[model samples]
Target: MTLLAFLLGLALGIGFWLWQRQRLQRQLKQMLGVLQTDASSTAMSVVSRLRQEIAQANEHRSQLEERLQTWRRLLEVAPLGYLQVDEENRLLCCNDQARHLLQIDRWEPRQLRLLLELVRSYELDQLIEQTRHQQKPTIQEWVFHPPCLDGEAMGEVRSLTLRASSWPLPHGHVGVFLENRQPLIELAQSRNQWFSDLAHELRTPLTSIRLVAEALQGRLENPARRWVEQLLHETNRLINLIQNWLELSNLEKNPSKSLTYQSLELRSLIQSAWQTLEPLAQQKQMCLAYVGPDTLWIRADEARLTQVFLNLFDNSIKHSHRQGTIRVEVTAREAQVLDSEGTVDSPPFSNASDQPDSDASPSLIQIDMIDTGSGFADSDLPHVFKRLYRGDPSRQKSQGTSEPFTLVGSSGSGLGLSIIQQIIQAHGGTVQARNHPETGGAWLQIKLPDHKNLS
Candidate 1:
């Protein structure tokens, strides 16, 4: 019985040990399975996030590439020169047009800055200064002798007008645009040449007529008087035409060119012009009167300004009927009034210091041509300065009344007022034609800057 009890106790101990070992094995298997599942889930999440990021990055790259290509195409195809420069004016990039125009190849940033060093013209230097200092776009032109005929023949000088526009960009970049203007320069040069040639042609005929008229003087008897007079009249008409041609030529050459200014009293000039036209006025039985102050002064080219006033006076006399009164008045006016009238009052005649203040002082000289003859049509006022324009052609064709002067055809070349207008404009003055409200006749007015501001 004691041996049986000891064996049973040993068996029990063995059974308990086996059961504890089994429980530990099962728990180990379950913990290993849970760790494997957690690792797989974490790896899958990482892979999914990386794939999405890669796809988004590819899409962004495609968009950027498309925009870059579009800009490249535009730079290549633009007609005018397109250039990019650094703040130091070194070339950064250039389009095809810029490369062709500037003769640039394998562009280096240093090349453009060096190109400017070769420019000797002062105009180009000024333009560059204006662009840099003013920070504004500027236009300039230069004449260059380019190689011609496929680089075989010597090229004639051709003008190239360049308009450069600069803009500030990111990274201190500057953009410049250039265009060619050779054609316009050529056209202007051609016009000047033509005007020069025409002046010479018209001069010869005038010289001949004046010489012949002087030779025929006092050689005609009473029986030949009419024919001689007609010849003389025609010669004078031709002379007037030639003079007009010369005046037009000068105007085209330099619209503002005039003689050195001189100081003179306005009343004196008007009195002289009036005396010169006195014979013509008297022949028409017209009274030529000056109704202005005697102390008025102006600064001007005496001869040119005299011619302007004289022309208007002569027109008045020629158009006025016999015994008509021609009135001349000088006064002051406001700036607003003259501007509204589309004209400027004639400047006081004197030196630059003696002229009237157009803003503050109301000093203006007005010469009125009032006539008793038939007035001009209002419709014809605007065109009175046009060449060969005639008012009352039928009446003019019938010749003058009482004075027996020829009124139409060649006596007035229709360029008198036109010449007057051009001369007045050159003097920084203005002229206007209107029918008189009181006398119901044609009135010609001249307005100029005050003498004090002549310079």
Candidate 2:
């Protein structure tokens, strides 16, 4: 019986060991399944994140493309000519206006062609080169003669005056803007021609009228004689007006023409000009204070320069209060000196003469004429030098009292300053008008190159 019990116990122990092994296998399978599920979830999360990034990248690229297209459209329709060039001076892009201005044939938008080959403009190329090298904006103006095609007349050169401004861009590129100034210039020339023709037509009629007035002046008496004298005065004023118009037309037509330049004393010229208007000055008891060298010299056309001073003096005398002083000051200095009151580099009516001949001189003569009169009306300063620009009638009437005795030349023709400015410009000089800061009077300043300084 003891032997049987031992065998049964051993069998029970083996059964227990088999049951534990089955339980451990079940636990291992459960752990493996859990690990596999976690790995799958991690992989799906990574894939989702990568897809979102790709989509965002595509959207950003699309936005960039849209912006680029918008810019292209705007540039294509711009009125001003626009051109873009690459580092190699190859034409990268241009607007229709640019193509028309350059007279270039149509080409593919992306095509790379040398700019010189298409336009053949040295000035444009030089402007671009300058901008690239200096990395700064540059402006240039030149008259371009378009290349003649076959069957075109050799003399039929199409000339265009163009102004171009260029600036550097990223990647060694340059951008240029072009403007055609031919139309505006032609319009100005047309207006000038019309005026000149009108002036010519009026001259003969004016001369005949003046002769008639003179004849009538002698054959009248008493109040009628006074009327005849007034008529003569009005007629003579008209004649002078016509003469001045013709003279101005001639000057505008060719500023440098018929110039007879000579060295003469400026102070003496001023005194001489003053002498012609002495009777008018004396009528008002106006004091003339000439504060300049008695023998300052300038190279100029004596007659024209005398007219300049006469006009200025007359203007001052007409505007000065009775017993008020008109002071004339003259000084010589280097070209670099800046006139604190006014610089004659730019005048009110028109562009001044080009800088005096580079080889000529480096000295400038400055003249200041100040009148202790009602200063230029603040509103009238800009228009003072424009042809036929009259000041306020009230102001003119008030100033008219200064020279009550001289009736004929008392009032301004409104052409005095304009003519004076032109005469000074013809001498390679400039003139400016302003109110004296200290004196509260009319101030006129002139600058002329000193010929004695020439090397």
Candidate 3:
């Protein structure tokens, strides 16, 4: 009986062990399957993300390329010559106009090359350097002489006067614009020549008519005598106009020929100019008042400056109220000139002998001539100095209240102020016309540089 129970127990134990081993193997196989599935899902997710990233990168690159193409197309059609340089003055891009203007043929856009190697212009290089240093827009004009082709001197050297404007850009880059001004200059020269020729042709006929009118004035009486006198006056006025035209033409043709500069006192010159027009001023009961140093000396052409003052005084006297006053003020001081390409005249100090050393400083002489008369019309102010410009009826009258001064010699040729401006500009001076704030009259201001400081 004991042996039978032991055998049954051993059998049961073996059966139980076999069942546990089978269960363990099944669990291991199930876990391994789950691990394989998770690994496959993670790898697919990574591949999808990489594809999306590549597509986005391609889209961004396409947009950038499109923008670059658009810019290039726009530049191709631009009329003005356009040029771009990198930080080191390397030519990065240029348009057709630029290539033609610079006479460059062996360059392509986007190819990096030194600007100096292609275009041999010192002025252009200097302009670029200046613009970069100042970080401001700069304008410069220079003549370009093309070199001979094929290293031979057989070709004609064409000279082009070019005006260039440059400005700074990002990353130390620069942009330049070019203009050709030779056409306008030539047109102006041709027009001046025609006008000078016409003025010369009219001189003899005008003189002959003046003589005939003078002869008829002695043979007429009363109303007829008055008519002859009027005709004589008109003829004489025409003759004066012709003479003035000729004189102005000569001055414009050769400014240096008309100028004979000398040191003269400002006060004395004013006094002398006023004397020439005293007869007209007295006729209108006008007075002259000067407020300045007793003597201010400046280097100037005495005769031309006297003419300037005389014209100004006459205009003032004609427009002055009867018994009204015209005031002249002169002042001098130092000022920083923004543009130093021109010369100027300066006033003298209080002491007659105290002359300024122009080499030591830049000085300006300001002359303000104000009148108590009808001010310039707003519409007429800009054209006051233009040749042959006559104002409208409202501007022609005195403050819209009375007739213009019609004295025999009072009617001007409408060229006086134009001539004044020309003379002053030739002397390296500037003139401005405005209505005085306090006096409510025409204000003419003249600014001249000190001659000693002129280069």
Candidate 4:
């Protein structure tokens, strides 16, 4: 009986231990399932948030691109040349007009670098230096006189007026603006020249009549004759001046009414001008010489050009010291080689099309009038060609010192240069006055388009 009880207790104890073990195993699997579900939920939440952030970032990028595109279009299509360069002189962007001006193609960020390297002119280099160092806007004028096709022709002459500025951008970029100046130059030339020439024509006749009347007053004692003669002379002068004014107005009103344009030898014109003024030159005892090429010719109006030389020679004679020498020199400028091995063909400014050796290119004819006389004061240089502008107010007063043979007669009504400027401009030319670089006297240079061989 005791052995049987022991066996049964052992069996029961073993069965209880096995059942507890299976229950523990089942509980452990349930715990594992709960942990896996939590992990999956957390991962899904993170992925969804990430996707939303990426979509927002893409939206922002699209908005930025649209804004950038709008700005780029405005920059590219603007009529004025637009450029953006960095402090390092690197071009970031340039408009079509800017490319045309620099004579460049396929504009790239690298092009700005090439331009900086290729642009060797002192004036342009100065502009860049000023912009980078000073951090301020600058204005400058650039005149391009390039040699014609492969240097076998004359290149067209073009002028550019550039206004460049730079300021700190939101993202650190620089901006620049460029404007064309051909029209402005033409307009200023027209307005200034017209007034100047009118003043000159008036002074000429007035001076002649004044001299005659003064002479008649002393020689003709008859009161009625003297009075009538004086009146007639003054009236004629007034009428001549008014008639010239009327003619000028008419020309402006009907611009299509073209004047005669012909090819005339420059040497012959100079000779004629010299002969016309010889008596006056001799009377003043001043030496007037023509130092120009024999074969050079200009396409211009004969009478008008003659008037330009006449005024210039007369002015030199009037202002020169007794026995002073007046020099008229002509120069044919040639294109310079850009690099050591690079050769540009022939000369510039001597032809019409600004291209050398071309059928259409006309050479430029320049006439320089240099006199060893008192030069204009520095302050008066800018206004020298203004109508009715008398040089040195003090000198105008000093006319009280009566001197005979003042043919031009004491600064000669202050219209000489104005008239010269007008006539030269009418012929599609330009004139400038400065102190002669070598002689330190008044130097007046007249440049006109030519059709003759500059070689």
CA-lDDT, candidates in order: 0.64, 0.77, 0.78, 0.62
Per-residue lDDT of model 2, residues 194-246, tens digit only: 87788788878878877887888788778887887887788777767777767
lDDT of 1 by residue, 1-455 (tens): 79999999989999999999999999999999999999999999999999999999999999999999899789889888877765565666777887666555555544556334332345434444456666656565655333343644345434466555555565555566767666666686687567557757766876787677667767877757667777778778777776665675576568766455777687789889888888877887888666555476667778887887677677677766767877765554555657544455443222334434534544344544455445565556666776556665544322344221222222377667777777777766667777666766666667766666656
How far in Å is the alpha carbon of 238 misplaced in model 2? 3.1
Quote each prediction's TM-score.
0.49, 0.70, 0.72, 0.48
Which candidate would rank higher by TM-score, 1 or 3? 3
lDDT of 4 by residue, 34-130 (tens): 9999999999999999999999999999999999999888878888887776666567778887776656554565455634653334555566666
Q: Which ten residues in a row have the lowest lDDT in candidate 3?
A: 401-410
Among these predicted structures, which one has the highest TM-score? 3
lDDT score of residue 255 within candidate 1? 70
lDDT of 1: 0.64
Tens-digit per-residue lDDT, 1-455, candidate 3 = 79989998888989998899999999999999999999999999999999999999999999999999998888878877889898999998888888888888878877899999999999999999999988999999988876666656546556778899898999899999987766776787788778768878887887888788788888878999998888888888877777776777777778766888888788899999998989989998888988766666788889999988988888888776778788887765556543354423343213323434433333677788888777676777878887667666554535443333221123367777778887888787888888777766778888877775333
